[model samples]
Target: MHGPDVSWYLALSGLMFTIGAIGVLVRRSPLIILLSVEIMLNGANLALIAFARHFGHADGQVFAIAVMAVAASEVVVGLGLIVAMGRRNIELDVDKLRTLRG
Candidate 1:
């Protein structure tokens, strides 16, 4: 039995990325947008790991780990903003956040 091909992995990553892009474009809630961005990041990480395995190199895996760290930081910052908005009684709607001008 043969292992899964790289093209299969690439195709799955592409599909996941497309779904994430759609979620980002179509969602209205700030939290949803953040989640969608995380999805996109995960999709990219999936591709990186897949390529690393295919190429038998560590660079892609290293970058994937870096991406994971960035994603974690993103969640922290995004949730902080959400909590701040809640404390300030700001709406969760992304369209209404335009008034946040300092």
Candidate 2:
């Protein structure tokens, strides 16, 4: 299998972002929206790693790692909120959950 070059990785990353964007736009559930946002972050990380490898620079890889840490933290916090919100009801509709928001 061919290793992904910068352009190919960038294209794939852009596609991932687009898919995530659509998911966020079309889904009415908070969990799905959060997952979609994660997809976007992963795409950006992929692009950063790709460019880092291509340029022989450590910065992009370092940034990618940082982004990953952020994404993980986001997932933890978002899921925690989701669980707290879920305890209130079975419905996952974003609109219904808005009432719980301050």
Q: Give residue 12's lDDT in candidate 1 (0 to 100).
A: 89
**Clash statistics: count for each candidate:** 0, 0
Task: Please report, in order, the local distance difference test score of every candidate based on alpha carbons.
Answer: 0.89, 0.88
Question: Tens-digit lDDT track for model 2 on 28-49?
Answer: 8888999999999988998898
Residue 72's C-alpha lDDT in candidate 1? 94
Q: lDDT (0-100) at residue 78 of candidate 2?
A: 89
Candidate 2 colliding pairs, count: 0
lDDT of 1 by residue, 1-102 (tens): 178888888888888889999989999898999989988898899899998988899999999999999999989999999999999998888877665661
Show model 2 residue runs off by greater than 4 Å.
1-4, 100-102
Which residue pairs in model 1 clash with each other? Answer: none
Off by over 4 Å in 1: 100-102
Highest-TM-score candidate: 1
lDDT for residue 66 in candidate 2, whole number 0-100: 94
Worst 10 residues of 2 by lDDT: 93-102
